[model samples]
Each structure stands twice: as structure tokens, then as C-alpha cells.
Target: MSELIQTYWPMIVAALVLGVAVAWFVFSTSRKTRVTGTSRDVLDEGAAPAERNKALIDSAPAATPMQPAGGAAATPDATGDDLTRIKGLGPKLAATLRDMGVTGFAQIAAWDDAEIDRIDARLGRFQGRIRRDDWVGQAKLLAQGEDAGFAQRYGKLS
Candidate 1:
């Protein structure tokens, strides 16, 4: 029994030492790097309103006035109604539509069920809203310079 213990004791000690060494090496290597304020300072405090505004302006696409809620009015550029003009479209869905060749309302209105289904498959969560909202018909009316049925249905147009 003593001989057996002696024989394995060195192996056990060596394994313990190796485990400690590996643990220390892993911990030491995982130390976080200190980030200098260079990147953060550029974006953080002391930024002037004009500079911030300019940065925002530069980062953002050129502003188009948002259409009224429920797409009550036609937008200035009649060529293509902005899909994002719909109230429900978030940035992600709008981008998805753009990816699916649905850049305009006319395109959406012109799309058959198969094409819309394809778009819906890509859009996932936005599918139900797109179908329920009648986005295509609204888009078509907007494209045709109609007052979105307010004049006809309500007897007065905005």
C-alpha cells in the first residue's frame, strides 16, 4: 500500500500543479484591456451642439417630411410612395421591404399574393400587419393622388 501511494503521489502533485498553472495562465490572459478615452472622448462630453447636430445630420439620411398618420395625404414625390410612410413600418421592416424590391407603394399594390407571401416570409413578424392594414391599397390611392378616401368617405379632404 505504501509503495503504491508513493508511486502515485508524484503524479497527483504534478497534476495539481499543472491545474493551478493552467488556471493562473487563463486568468492572467483574460485581464481586460483599459480603453483610453480617445474613442469615448470623441463621442462623449464637451461636444458642441452644432458639432453634434452636424454629426447627426451627416449620419442620418436626408430628411423627408413624414406623411400624416393613416397615410391621409400624398407625399411630394409621386413617383414612389415611401413604404416607410406607413405608420407601422419600423426601420427593420422598411429595410426588409427595400431588400425585397418593395421600394414604393405602387410596387406593393402591384404585387400578387405570391410575391407578397414571399415578402412576408422574409419579413416574418411584419406579415400580419402588412396584410391586415391594406398597405397596398393605401399605397395605390396615395400613388394615384387620392386624399386617402378622406374626401370621398368623410366629405372633406385635408
Candidate 2:
């Protein structure tokens, strides 16, 4: 084994490097931006007049039922709130969710663990985000109009 390793060390190193490259590509392309500690915590929930972290709409087309953007599609049908308001969810992911028929907080809040797993599977690269960011917990408060509660835990969404 030692003699073989010495003879083929370059090959082994190259294989390891290739594997690392693939992993990096897979992870960087699929995963959403990481959440910061400050961004995750709601600093102010009581300040109704103050609107922080307002929804940033992309330069996408507005259509009924769904507004598709050029790349990062923004906005959903009349019933849907800005899905990007949730932490770890960016414009691209929001568009993907919209394509999957996930429109609003109500829809997300209603997802059971089983449903989350099912949905997560279809997320392609954005898998496991639902549980990781605790979207359901945030959605539950948002769905119920509990801004204070949401702000208290998951931060404010304008």
C-alpha cells in the first residue's frame, strides 16, 4: 500500500482536487446566501411606523397570477407577499418557489414536515432551506399578522 501510494501520489492528489472542485461548484451554485446573526434576529418589532428590510423587487415583468422577472423574478399573484422577505430566501429562490406553486406565507405556513421534505426535494439546489431558516415558524407569524411575534423571532418584513 505504501509503495503504491508513493508511485501514484500525483494521481491521488489530482483525484482529490477534482472531487473538491465538484463539491465547491455544487455547493456555491445551489445554496442561497448565508444568513448573518444580525439579519436573523429582529431588532425592532414594536416600531410599526418604522419599516426596515423592505422588500426589494427586481426589474421583472408584472403579470396576473405571477410576475416573472428576467432572471430573479419578483412578486407573486395578488395574494402572495414577497417571499424574499424571509431570511435566506433571495429573488431567485422566490421565483423558484413561485414556479412550484408556493405563493404566500399561508402556503408555506401550512406545510407539514412531510410536505416540507417533498417540497425541499424539488427545490433542486435550494434544498433543506425550509428547515434551516425556520421558514415555517416565520410564516406562521406572518400568516397570522403577528408582526411583533415574527419580528421578535425571525426579524421584521416590510
Scored by TM-score, the top model is 2
lDDT per model vs. reference: 0.62, 0.75
Span of 10 residues, lowest total lDDT, candidate 2: 66-75
Model 1, range 1-158, lDDT digits (tens) per residue? 99998989999899999999999999998896776665444445785456857888779576453222233232334444455655456678877665544566656666566655666676676667767766666666656667756245423432
TM-score of each: 0.42, 0.49
lDDT of 2 by residue, 1-158 (tens): 99999999999999999999999999988887865665433446754432434433433545543222222323336778888888888999888888776788877877777678877887898898999999888877877788888888876665
Return the number of clashes found in candidate 1.
Answer: 0
Report clash pairs, candidate 2: none
Model 2 ranges with Cα > 4 A deviation: 1-79
TM-score of 2: 0.49
- lDDT of the structure predicted as candidate 2: 0.75
